[model samples]
Target: MSKTVGAEGWTVVHQARQKHYDDRYYGQFLGTRKDGRWIVGRMWSGRSMDDGFHDGGWDWSKRFAEPSSTDAADAALKSYVEMSHETFVWNRVFEQRVGEAIDAYWAGPEVPGAPRLSAGWCRTPDGLPGGSTVGLPFHEAKYRLLQYLRSTESTARADLSPRTFNLHDAVELIRQANGPFRFQHGYNAYWLADDAS
Candidate 1:
């Protein structure tokens, strides 16, 4: 049933189809029972049509209960909708944070004594090597670096074979590395480009 509140307070408003007595269904003047008893009936929301009895036939002996105050209903609806909107906002914020962390790690100054390869190895100015056959030894440093790269490009290509460095293998290597910048399951493939950096 539907309820509406006027300027004063809650009141049973009668529509064309049925009269709503505070969430309880009330029959319209027409099609009511032969007896003078006011039968409660169900009606479709926003429609002027009675949906018949609620399981059994209508009952009028029960006292009508007042619907929630209009202010309370409005507040509840507003809170529910706002909560749903906030969930989406938080999800986007989380994704952005992940993206920011990945970007910072990539652009940050190189680690001291980190494995240094020629510019021909990786195309990025970071001087990391990039190749199809460069089987990076299953090591921690390599794992962290791969995780950072994979955050930006999920399907980055690598030359390492499934035997040498499949996706799972690379992820495990990164886990073993266990560095502050490491991720759990990120590395997908190696970057296959001329090391122009």
Candidate 2:
């Protein structure tokens, strides 16, 4: 059986446990009643928080919009209707609004009683896909280890053949070296050992 709990204009539901899941991961699906429709418009409230997050005054009381589920639903309905009336339901209006909301959320004024998050990131050693590099990087020791491996293992020898090694072997090498490295575990790994099948 399932129950729908309301708050600050939102309907909160206990999401079903995923098959084969192992963690104590719990989440809620927030929905809005628009006209006669139950719209799961808002994103999932993350897979780790509590259902009581709604009742807890320390959550988003200060920063977030209206605090009543019914009111929140009404507001969402207005936003939905407005967004739907302009262009399509999925249009630049909603996109721009979402972007603005995200920007504002990040540039927070720091709610007086809200929980605080403290974190920082360094830069990646080789840069990211788009050629722009930045953000919380691995420990400097990891970079030094990578450099050492590259300098020593990047060479090709007549006796050294990719046909002799496999992705598992490479992973084992990393494990032996006590790595913070994770195998990419994709098509790239399939081609690592030349004849890996």
Best of the candidates, lDDT = 1
Which candidate tops TM-score? 1
Q: Report the number of clashing residue pairs per model.
A: 7, 12
Estimate the TM-score for candidate 1.
Answer: 0.24
Q: Write the per-residue lDDT of candidate 1 for residues 1-197, one digit (tens) a residue.
A: 12322232222222223334344333321111112122122222322235432333332212222232222322322332333232222233433333333223222334565443211123332434444333222232343354444443443444422333544444334434422222222223233222233
Error of 2 at 164 (Å): 29
**For residues 106-128, could you state the per-residue lDDT of candidate 2 as single tens digits?**
22233343322211111123322
Backbone clashes in model 1, listed as residue pairs = 121-129, 121-130, 122-129, 122-130, 132-159, 157-190, 158-190
Error of 1 at 41 (Å): 41
TM-score of candidate 2 versus the correct structure, residues matched by position: 0.19
